[model samples]
Target: MADTGLASERPLRSASFRWFLGGQSISLLGSAMSPVALAFAVLEATGSAAWLAAVTTAALVPMVAALLLGGGVADRHRRDSVLRLTSVGAGLTQAGVACVLLTHQHPAFLLPLCAFSGVFQGLTKPALRGIVANLAAGRGIQRASSLLASVRNTTKIIGPTTAGLLTASVGGGWAIAADAVSFLLAAVCFARMSLPDRPQRTADDPTMLGALREGWGYFSSQPWIWAVTLAFAVNNGFNLGVWQILGPVVANGTIGARGWGLVLSARGAGALLASVVMVKLTVRRPMGPALASMSLAAVPLILLGAGADTLWLAAASFVAGVATEFFTVVWETVNTTHIPERLLSRVGAHDEFWSFVPIPVSQLSTPFLAAAFGTASVAVLGGATAAVAMLLPLLVPALRRIEIHRQGE
Candidate 1:
């Protein structure tokens, strides 16, 4: 295996990777800011949890629907081109959202705008994963994943706090505007990036539908992949749904928006710390540790359900961040290393599609569930469900036995 020290530095040596990382860093900063900004904007304007759920659900549903098409397009075309185009589209839609929010906080206008952005997001998601796999191929996928996670986590730390301050002082529209600018800047960076040449597709190449089916066949054939994806389908509905939709609502009553931002920032801080550790850490049996760490995701949800104070909530979020980041780096590395490069994007899309399918349901249902069962009860139940779901994949022998070997191993 490549020496841990050398492996960590190798991905950075590539100029293309550098550009990719730089663009993603700037873009993630804005994206990190966006949820906080958008959540508060919707909540403050509508003052209805259901409305907030509706607006957020609008974005997620289309993204989930578009994943397979986007994945096929990404695998067939130059991944960088897909990224650049999608970034531009997302930027434009986000700008429209900012403009509407600034002029009049209208849910009617926001729904379609957010849905458009989500389509761009669907197009962008698989391409983003494929590009990293391409850029960092044969040069420490784990390190590359860690670096990306580090930047993302770092931005989360800064973005939410900034969004909170902006939302509190100038209004959420400006913060959303900042996110739009970042997307444009990222598009510019993506345009300039150069990737290794992909094999030209031939007339014999499968049609998009055929290709998607093939991808699904491979994805479902892999017990490890399908099992984990299935688990996340259930887990995300609980973890992300509660955290994103109900989190702000709970905070609105208790910790306030600014405090909520801080709690998220604390989670970012923990993830950033984990990213640093992952750069040096080596795991032969990655799946076990990955899923084990993922179970920690339940902590903050449980805490939030219990109406923990700001300090306690932040602390729990921090721990969850660490766990989540560890899982992310391991998961990305395993996929990149094990999957064929040509099929990676489509497979990734399938993985993402299944994993995220439940998110919209969670977002749409949580508000009503909370209304009926009470937010705290729902949250605790969600956390318990997430914890159990995260561990169930461990029972799959293929997943438990999966191991990775670095270069020279």
Candidate 2:
């Protein structure tokens, strides 16, 4: 028998999946441009990286907190409604940024606005994932996740490169306004989505708090989840700190501003190719070990830092992108498939809150780390530590059994 890529017999579900992918593709594109636009605007106006630095730092709290609270709410409420409402809120927020830009408003407003966007995301991201899990169904989850990774990479390609050109030509204000318009388009897509009834808790279940607690227990019971979540939090925090502290200085001051844009775009291109390759993969449940393996592959952040050139950086960036997408897709798909849908968002929050907990601290401290160790050395250390963290987990037998076949067994 010939195997068509179509996992489901029903055409309607397939159409819905396409619609979901289309919306996300548009959303990812605009988002990719945002950091480039924001950073450039800050530098051009104040002639100081301080504004960009401060807002990036300020964003950490609201993002993690909002994500936590939003996850709690998402588990208790209808995920569809939550996503719809937040998408509108996010669009309106972008509109406000656009209005500031359209009026030729001060660049001073940009950082705080970016921070606000972080708050908006904290509320919506969990629900977004929960919705995808519902939409993907069991058989289609891997493909759906892969499609998401590809779209994300595609946006990475479009966003930064476009922002670079746009900022160079039109000015930062207008580029920001373009991002705002993308959010409105995202809202329209969210409205058109028709999702199935969210998997409901059985009638005997208690309050939302009780439900939340149960999710906590369930996640805690899994040692590997806890271990990996901790590793990511620390690794992500450390990496972000380095990126924020060093990337701008290198790309703008040392490497050249255009270099930063190209470096970012190259990584996205790499991830896109990786996502395409992974989509056709079929294996018995092995997300856990795959995750550990890919995490080690991140060792090149060291190479990326030490090399730092068009050719060197691009090659390193490509490998890093491929590794990141592989781990991320496996991580998300495993979570979506294994965790009960009713508790999906809350569980996601639990994972995110803990895992991403170090981001703010890391972002805040990077400048100091760079000042103390020097940018190149600091980046090299971060990369080394991250690579070590990924492989050390092999000592845990639970992580070795992470394939789908062993989940909850």
Candidate 3:
């Protein structure tokens, strides 16, 4: 495929990309709501945080385990078809959860249903990456990614609030039902998309294991890709633990829950603003800027450790959000432009899998670390570690050398 100049061809002008964007926007909104609704439903039914934790773990573990398999499947089939099937599967599982909640309220029933839903969720992730690359060739990748990020940030603001209202009025079951419907509707949109044909696999094609090994080889060979992935693996763990786990405790002592909520809102607003700005701006070489921006993430954690006022914390969070979103768009665009289409899903899966592997560890260990070293101390240390992780990628000469050119250039 020839490079499509960003000025000459806007991603939205493509009917297929429009369809993709519309479906993903709706689907993401529902996904954002699902966790809130599920949390309330689990509490209402079981009345135990332990059970809720178990249910949540059940869902997440399966998703993580399935990621490599999902990547393989996505690479083997049409990406859109994979999306359609996974959406249908996820929708059905959610419907089952709704039925279980509405009638018997068997908490154990949720385990299998949510586990299956998580599997479907895992399957969709890599296919989503592949489909976006297919729909937005060349420089349009950045525009498409920015547009998608904008919708995602907007939904993060709206979806939970909507779910809370629905849960309060009707019930958590009904809110989940709404999520199920959204997935099914998204499946319809996927069915309607017109994607280019993929090359047919021959009998001589490598087996799934072999294909995965091939993907691993390619991923490892690219210092820019693996280096960034390694940095994120460390940075995300510290960021999540400090910001999500310790920040709440710090808020209770200083800013209060309401203040914490406002700070989070500011972050979302900042991300949305960055997404809008990135639609017009072009970065020929994104990795250096992306890594540099990621260091901004440390500010809010350090502020919380310092016992800053709510306004100061919120200001830091807003900048962090802008930095996070900017890095995300640039990272996605880099992958789409540089990685071969055949291996894109596999590489993306590896990136996501490693990035997520440390999350559970952080979630599990943060409180222990806090109890031993004190919450404020841990937050400060975490922020410093994250900043180092983000900046360390700059030391890799290969990562710093990567560049993408505009079509006409």
Candidate 4:
């Protein structure tokens, strides 16, 4: 490990950073509610796996499509400003969905509305990544990232259960409305933030396309970024996308709704524990360690596919969550140290786009695959594929050798 001086110090002592963290903590908690709520809502509305896949794919399409443009916009403008504006827009979109659903109307436009929300939310990604790197600079990016993940994981513990209960009691539409309110609150918090200015550019500076090209150039040149992203594209196909589509079904049928909530909370509990550990833990040769951690995440998938009892499944999910956070912290630390700050947002956008592009495919095909091969077979196959994919990037020497260094060192 390269010298990360004074790793013992905490970054949250900075008031502005604290506020940023606080706002995000609340926002993420609320945002966390949406996934379970939305999944169950669609499942209830149509009772078809295909409908769930379609809605999810609709949301991701716009998110993936607008990523490069979003990156360019974030790099060119004030990231804080971009974040605030996008947050408000996203809140409204979600609120709109809630109202439409609350009126007892058919969800004729849910897909388009979700797509619009995706666009706004997508634009915020590069800005969010840029903001974190700026605020955490030289104050121990690893610790800072770990702290952020800790906040999110903590919410993940509460959010799903909250959403599940609310869905059981009030309905998923209202739960989504709560997520909208959280976005608005996050927007207010963002509006109060102050950060260092970005680099000034003259009229002769690169066009949006030119900036995108530059970002792709930088991202592609880094063997670690591209290689890891390629692996994640496959990993996400199996883990995130497929899991999202199938989890609710599995949860409802086998585990019961409340039982599923407990299972998810168990996963979140493990993630929370991992993040807490990451706050004090620093690893050398992050690539190999990260991959090793990620390989363990497949355990829950295997257990779920086998229709293990709730207790065993939750235990496996908890362990998988712990392994996930290990990978997440190391990955963020590496990227923050390696990428140039000016291009971080754009590079992050490329990273997000490529890493997540396969999600819609994974989600869209999950139902068909499940129908064809049976959900158990699909789950096992996906989980096995993910385990294999996580290690593939290790074969690249550049990735394995990558290390972090303090900025001025």
Candidate closest to the true structure, highest lDDT: 1
lDDT of 1 by residue, 190-279 (tens): 877777556887999899899999899999899999999999999998988878898999888777779999999999999999999998
Count clashing pairs, candidate 3: 0
Which has the better TM-score: candidate 1, or candidate 4?
1
The lDDT values for all models are 0.88, 0.70, 0.79, 0.83
Candidate 3 RMSD to the correct structure: 3.6
| Per-model TM-score versus the true fold | 0.97, 0.89, 0.86, 0.95
Task: Summing lDDT over every window of 10 consecutive residues in candidate 1, give the lowest-scoring window.
Answer: 1-10
Which should have the higher lDDT, number 1 or number 4? Answer: 1
Of models 2 and 4, which has the larger lDDT?
A: 4
What ordering of candidates by TM-score runs from best to worst?
A: 1, 4, 2, 3
Residue 184 Cα positional deviation in candidate 2, in Å, after optimal superposition: 1.1
Steric collisions counted per model: 3, 4, 0, 0
In candidate 1, clashing pairs total 3
Candidate 1 yields a Cα-based lDDT of 0.88
Query: By TM-score, how accurate is candidate 1?
Result: 0.97
Q: Write the residue-wise lDDT of candidate 4 on 60-117 in tens digits.
A: 9899888888999998888878878988998999998888767766666788889999
